[model samples]
Target: MPKIPECDRCRFYCGSHYLVCAVLPSGPDGKECHHFAPEPNAEPQELWEPQGARYIDDELVIERVTYNGEEIIQPPQRWSREKKLWLLDNHPMFTGLCPSCGAEFERDFTARVHWDCPECGWKDDSV
Candidate 1:
């Protein structure tokens, strides 16, 4: 048996160490197996700013909507490299850089959102 990467996104690990089994088959060696199939990982999704007010069952939701008719949702705010560097220097939870482009941005955990990198359009979802 080969070591496999721990997958924390599977639902099977609901209790008892929350142990996630290897998604890959073939004994976790990336080999071929009859049951070999990629397990669904709960990868986070990007949250984009909505364009309009949303209503459900004739009830209005105010958490994500604005008071006016316009949808003033949370959009990425632009910051200069200096600002990013400052954040990197000061913040404790900043993580990984985008390889597509060398732009940096902060992840807001409280909001569960991330601002898109100004230099490149990289988005972080696990903020």
Candidate 2:
């Protein structure tokens, strides 16, 4: 069995485990310390942890799962096929006005089969 170290009898010892003390936080390099003093109560110190950190019913709950070392999240929904088709017809990006000629529509003529201008050969990809 290993022998108890010198800091065990020191007054400033704050043994909460993982090598911690009030005066010698990381513990003394040698078995003996200059600031060694007897504890006021001189009772055996027991190791402990936070109330939430300890096991509840003999089962640990601190375990966690990750996605490639990162938390997994739900991705954003994609646009529907119908919405894409509607945007292609009415949206200005697909069809707006003739580029080669100065021919513009009064209202949105999205149902038109050919987007090419009648007066000019300007085309809008026939969208």
Candidate 3:
């Protein structure tokens, strides 16, 4: 009959066998069976370090570094006329203007789409 290893010396025979053990039996005394499991094809944990500002060269001298240099060209900003018109027509600040009294009114832009002029009580006119 094959003898089953005693639990007192077997590292694989833990109270809970939820995790698998890769360690082989050392000897009869089981002196090295203290949760000694070999990690097979396991990758090492990577530690992250914070990165700061980087420089190309340690000792680099600038001859003429102007704040507003002519060579420092900026790209022109792109705008849509149709979108601007739509925003102007739909915006609460512009659309809430009273036609009769010509007074600017405040309205909740997020809650409601329709706005009423506070001064003249006018309901519907595109500002």
Candidate 4:
């Protein structure tokens, strides 16, 4: 009952649990079988896998990070959260009024970048 490795690639191999092959029912007698005929196509082939990946729960999972076909650039934050909150609450850019003279700025603040006050001559140096 010596099951030789040549049984998998042999032409007379009957893919079964009980039977080893058609030519030899209990497999080959020795390491090399005389009745062994090479089968071009073999069953139970190994699946091809990509590098830097592994099979997890029968699914292929990549280890490295993958991004879309676009250049990624992140600008540094100039001010802290407290400074931003202070600017939003008191600054003429967000309040639409000068902090020194209390003069009302232009209603359309979105279009304007420079928040300089014309009445009190308060220049916007924060931006």
Scored by lDDT, the top model is: 4
lDDT of 1 at 68: 70
Worst 10 residues of 3 by lDDT: 52-61
Model 1, CA-based lDDT: 0.43
Instruction: Report the C-alpha lDDT of model 1 over 6-124, residue by residue, as the tens digit.
Output: 32233322212222243432233453333333338555322233344334433433344455777565444466579778667543345544545755545554653555666766565
Per-candidate Cα lDDT values, in order, are 0.43, 0.57, 0.43, 0.74
The TM-scores, one per candidate, come to 0.19, 0.30, 0.22, 0.38
lDDT of 3: 0.43
Minimum summed lDDT over a 10-residue window in model 1 is located at: 11-20
lDDT of 2 by residue, 1-127 (tens): 1124656566777554554467667776665677778876777644344333443334433433477888654343355679778766654445565555656754556566656667776555534
In model 2, state the lDDT of residue 126: 31
The number of clashing residue pairs in model 4 is 0
Error of 3 at 110 (Å): 1.7
- RMSD of model 2, in Å? 18.8
Separate clash counts for every candidate: 0, 0, 0, 0
Worst 10 residues of 2 by lDDT: 49-58
Model 2 segments beyond 4 Å from truth? Answer: 1-4, 46-127
Q: Which stretches of candidate 3 lie over 4 Å from their true place?
A: 1-96, 125-127
Tens digits of per-residue lDDT for model 3 on 1-127?
1112343234443222232233333332343344544345443322232232222223222233335654432333344578677657654556665546777765565565556767767675332
Which is the better candidate, 2 or 3, if ranked by TM-score? 2
**Model 4 worst lDDT run, 10 consecutive residues:** 69-78
User: In model 4, what lDDT does residue 114 have?
Assistant: 79
